[model samples]
Target: MSGYCGASALNRFVNDLLFFRNRLPLHVAEFSSYGGDNFDEAVQYLELWIRYSLSCPVAKLSVTSHDKYQRWLLPKGLITSEHLTALQLTRVKTQDDLDFSSCVSLKHLKMTDCGIYCDRIMSPSLKRLMIAQCHFIGYARTQIYASNLILLLLVDCMGMTPLLVSMPYLVEAFIRLGYCNDFCKHSYEIGDCGDESCWGCQFYEDNYGNNNCILLHGLSSCTNLELTAATAPFIFRKDLTRCPVFSKLKTLLLNEWCITNNLGALICFLQHSPVLEKLIIQFEPPEIHERLVEIGGSYDLRKQSLVLKDLNVEVRCDDGDERVHKVLDVLGSYGLSPEKFKIQRPPKLTRARFDDTWTSGSFSFEQEI
Candidate 1:
């Protein structure tokens, strides 16, 4: 139902749904509501509808609120559903401490453009979890516990990157941290930032002790993984010291952040992934005075062991040849032969074209080291 409908109409719709009490085992249920003249009443009706639908034992449920000014709290019943297998929430505000352990049968869960005010998300049966364009509003970092998760996509998420608990079955994951994330607010290079007052640095030091693995250890089992961030985030760089050996990883994709600090992070991954086959690097235009800022300690690439079958590098700037040469020089030092890699450059570069390169895989091979 559209938010344009008045409260009376909404109440009528709920009444109609209540009238059809025989409709048990609902295959799918979707509800949308934006701010209306009677906002509070609309919310009440929406909650009522949600509660009634849960009683029908919905297999799949999707709730979306288009009102940007306010976010509707998810009904408690939705969180504790036994029949819900798939759930998608958009523009909704979760409670202060959101937990989904009660969703025993839920397999797929996706949240987009939502406010996450919780400190942890715990689920046992979830196989696929995707959170995109969401804001995590809590002061402490959110921990994700989805032991059975096989696929995870966390794209453009803001506010302290969530810590991933071990998911031994995870096969694929794509994490792209946005510019508004907490780590991006700091100016100094991650890990090396000596500012005593910087919370970002302190948070990393305190949270990432010898035993704590912020991301890499949990993601070690994934066969295919993509790690991208706007303005180099600290989690990836900090986790490098304790980065678990990606024994199962075959394909890996990294962005400019990996090479920010003299290609140390890039080389570290190569050294760790013994059986890695294909590696793709997406290089953005370099700033005029953007010198390589050292974040992680340098690795001796001469001791590298992993031999990649194919390495694709796509440069998004016109003066990419020089940069590409520099990159090859570094890799060459690490014993990666010229024939193992290919370079691609589009005639006209745009963000859309750059993003499409991942799926298209159509390279001219005009520039090969």
Candidate 2:
């Protein structure tokens, strides 16, 4: 398997997985984007990979097709439209949709900037999902319902939440809501075009990062959850739940400044997610609040059920008294031995921003917190 014949043989090996796969595995699985006078040749390549490579034990899908990349621009029937001008996509074809239902054994799916969740798709074997800057994602029933699935990320999908897919048993989910201020134009461009048919900014905005809000609604259902956000404003209302859930969660991350009574949120967290063991509190510069030592001597967590094992902290500067000891007092009260603490004053903050009206002094902690 050397040149073009090697590619062809690999394609054949991948196209029909039932044809004795698990031999020497073809390392890279790619979706060709060559939209020429002869488009069938490319579809043959995609169909082969989607059909074959996915059948193995350690399947890898790095979807970068002209179709997959631009799947966001194509509507229900317009992907195959004969009228070329009617579409905003660069490649036009009769290629059938590529899904992962057959790839139930897949462990890794990397679709960066793709048109995913367009159908009732699921990857029961998926363990990793990485999606970057993509377009419209049609709401599939459940793109990932696998119990084995872990680690999933969606970045820069400016306009839509193409990620409403729910996983009942995920252990780690890291999501950043919203996008760069520059990409805001892309959101407005793909807006709903039907004023007479009922469409507006909000309707169209429902497509990208806005849809990441789906994670909030799906959180209570995720008992085995450990998630981190770069300061998302999705403060779930009281009716959402009195206590936050993460019963099996062991590690929590904070990339920027985190402000609260610190204890109030902890009260709610311990009230529900009792099994938590490791808590990481990271702070950015200027507001690192210094590091908490044995502040206020010690304070109790109020709820006595929490048994946290570790508190690994990274602070930007060693400056303020308000920052350090307050948190230490909170942990000391929780019965955490001093030897279990892993604290680092980084002297600099990571490039992240957080907005806590309670912490920023716009509102008083006694009032809001």
Model 2 Cα lDDT, one tens digit per residue, 149-265: 555555445443433454655655544544322122222222122343333323433432223334543343333332323322222211112233555655554333233446544
C-alpha lDDT score of every prediction, in listed order? 0.70, 0.40
Q: Which candidate is the best by lDDT?
A: 1
- Candidate 2 global lDDT: 0.40
Kindly report which residue stretches of model 1 are placed more than 4 angstroms away from their true locations once superposed. 1-7, 34-37, 76-78, 184-194, 208-210, 287-292, 295-321, 346-369
- TM-scores for the candidates: 0.84, 0.50
How would you encode candidate 1's per-residue C-alpha lDDT over 122-181 as one tens digit per residue? Answer: 888998888888888536788888999988878787777788888899987887777545
Model 1, position 273, has a per-residue lDDT of 89
Clashes of each: 0, 12
Model 2, C-alpha of 169: deviation from truth (Å): 4.3
List where candidate 2 sits over 4 angstroms from the true fold: 1-28, 31-61, 65-99, 117-121, 133-144, 155-157, 160-169, 180-226, 235-244, 256-258, 261-263, 286-322, 329-342, 346-369
RMSD of 1: 4.9
Error of 2 at 94 (Å): 14
